[model samples]
Target: MWALDSGICNSLEQPIKRCTAKVIAFDLETDKTVKTVDLSDILKPHSRPQYLVTDYSPNGFPYVYISDAEGAIIVLDIHHNKMYRVVLPRAISAGCGESDVLYLLLVRRPKNQNMVIFSYLCGNKVYGIKSEFLRTGRGSSAIVELGSKTKHSVLLGTDGSNGVILRYRSESELYKWNTDQPYKECNFELVQLAEECRLSTHVAPGGKDALMYSLSSNVADYLNHTCGAGGASARLKYISKECEDDCY
Candidate 1:
């Protein structure tokens, strides 16, 4: 089953006050429609329904979290046949995929300030953590640089149960696996190893899949030996140098 995004249907021809878009779910197996949710009253007219992200509830319910470009997250309770909205402090940029934990990654900045901040949404509330280690530069540039450096990052599997797992290319020219139990309030750490890798929390479950990098040089040697490239294979290309425009 998949969700369909019906873009702005002309309200001028229709007998309605506002333009309404519908999200419909189809049962591919039975070839029948399951449910239809109208988004006109809940979301603004200009909010494009093109890119929608879905997250299954970890609480073992049929509550599917649906988010769109306009920062609106609608929780559709399939069992209860009701829909509710999650109050977001700001537009969420990241969230868990396939995992049972309903964690959302949020990046916040103060108005007219030269600072970039990171926070997480768990248990229906936004919580800010100590991320001084992530502040590489001042102002928006810092966030931009961090985002650029970690652009090739991945969401590795969680820490066993109820934990967040992330893997990304670091600014230190090393591939690292960042793991933490954000829901449990545990200390997060970045490990210089890659045993498992996953996807970004901000992207859809089947969206852009991230490439997993192995930290061990032996893996590179093995690939080189098998392929007979001898030097600088695609595996080694995973390691990258810091950008020259780096503020720090």
Candidate 2:
């Protein structure tokens, strides 16, 4: 197994001769250093000064996905005890926050095909793409525009077993994709919250909990044991935001 750390050198190599932040790779088996690579050539300047590995594959192969702040991703293939960098597709936006871009390592059941799913935000629009482009580094299929352009957009998690979930400001919707067929339109359902309820959505680790926040009312609703899965039920509880001294 291998791990990656940005802005810090944990490998055996000395300091890299570059102005950009350094990315270090570590071998988890021996807990020793693996190799270090400079981000200057991979990512643009003033971009995300740090990079972290994403769990894209479940197998025992030492494949790590490292991403920068500007929505650019790199695949580090650690085979034969050597590290190689593979450039993946990147998001191009004239204006968009770094947080608006999301990358997920997804797997198709039974066949066990590994693919990277990415969503890029441009203004109020969100585009999703799933392909082997990450592996071959080119010829990625065209981007799929998601829903009507909403005022706000958030790409939640998808475990392949369930479906894809997305939140547009106050509205959350679940999309089901048939993995057996090619890319096409998906079936969707809007998750009900409350009247005129506008909020952001967050899924806890392991998709155990789904959190919905209404900043206007300083309130949050916790959906217990729900991760926006297809046809999965949810339980809602209202909680007041904790203030400096008052809990209301």
> Residue 102 deviation, candidate 1, in Å?
15
Q: Rate the local accuracy (lDDT) of all candidates.
A: 0.36, 0.42
Query: Can you write out model 1's per-residue Cα lDDT over 89-198, one digit (the tens) per residue?
Result: 44233542222132333222233121111222222222322122122112222222122121333333332222334443322222222222122222434433332221
Residue 229 shift from truth in candidate 2, angstroms: 35
Q: Write the per-residue lDDT of candidate 2 for residues 39-153, one digit (tens) a residue.
A: 5565565444333433333455445555444655565554433333433344344366754443343433444344444444444344444433444445235445444443544
- The reply for model 1, stretches above 4 Å from the true place, is 8-19, 50-61, 91-248
Q: How do the predictions measure up, each by TM-score?
A: 0.36, 0.48
Error of 1 at 53 (Å): 5.5
Query: What TM-score would you give candidate 2 relative to the actual structure?
Result: 0.48
**Root-mean-square deviation per candidate:** 15.7, 11.1
